[model samples]
Each structure stands twice: as structure tokens, then as C-alpha cells.
Target: MSQETEPEPSPGPKQENGPTTTGSFLCLHTSPPLHIALHGMSALTHTRLSRTAFDLCLELLEAGVKPQALADIVVHILEFKEQFN
Candidate 1:
């Protein structure tokens, strides 16, 4: 997938696997294209999990994951989360 170069995120607490509710997820409040630009292919996956690909990508971008690397990271996050669940 195409990569977007971004910066690293500041250290903070990590998240856990959980179900998503409309009130719990992020970016859903924003315009669809903006959401798509940020989350890409992982949009639905993150939404279903009560997670936010946009939020994840922002954090990943801050962590130097780069925009282009987001899709891959989302894929990895999803796979990893699914592996144990």
C-alpha cells in the first residue's frame, strides 16, 4: 500500500480489544472523505471493533509510521487482535 510519512506519538497507555458503540468510536463525527483519507481500507474494521483507524493512524503517524504505512499497520493490528480473539 502507498505510505504516508508521519511522526511518532508520545508515549501513553495502550488500548485493548473491545466492541464498538457509536458513542465510543472516533472520526465517525467527521465527514466521510476526511475519515476515508485517514483510515483508508481499515475504516470498517476499526469501526466494527469500537476502534478508530483515523485515531490509530494519527498515533501511528506520530510514531513515525507514516501515512503510507497506516494500511499495513491497520492490517497488522486487526490480524493481531483477531488472532487471540
Candidate 2:
């Protein structure tokens, strides 16, 4: 059964030195829902994939999700996908 999660706090401005609040996100440890979304996004054409990734990140930022971590995950996934071609 799926358990409900607590809502994440909205992202704040970056802190100087030490970890920022969002730093705790750690993309590799992302939840299953996000992993599914990223996997679906990876199926698009090259240009579309890039644009879709960017748009998803922008939406995540607006939703107060971990944009930087999502961006990193997108980049890493894209890089891994590209290497096999």
C-alpha cells in the first residue's frame, strides 16, 4: 500500500557555505513517482527530451520541488542514454 508523504517545504534562497535546504533532496534517492516521470520523459526525441526535461524542472521549481536535484538527475539520465548510441 502507498503511504502519503508530508509536503516538502518551499525552496528558499541558497545558503552561503554549508548545505542549503534543498541540498538534502539528493536526486538519486528520489521517490518512485519522480523516477517514473523521469523515465517517461527519457522516451522523447533528443530535442524534445531536452526541452521536456527543462520544462519539467521549471514546473518543479514553481511547485517548490527540488529543481536542482531534478535537473541533475535529468542530465545524468540523458548522459547515460546518450552513451549507448
Q: For each of the candidates, give the backbone clash count.
A: 13, 0
Give me the displacement of residue 47 in model 2, in angstroms: 9.9
lDDT of each: 0.55, 0.59
RMSD of 2: 16.6
Error of 1 at 50 (Å): 3.0
lDDT of 2 by residue, 1-85 (tens): 9999999999999656432234434242234466566556655544346545655664566457775687678779878997998
TM-score of each: 0.32, 0.36
Model 2 / residue 32 / CA error / Å? 32
- The reply for model 2, stretches above 4 Å from the true place, is 1-49
Per-residue accuracy of model 1 over 1-85 as CA lDDT, tens digit each:
9999888988888664343233323323335564556465556444444345456554455455555577676668878988999
TM-score of candidate 1 to 2 decimals: 0.32
TM-score of 2: 0.36
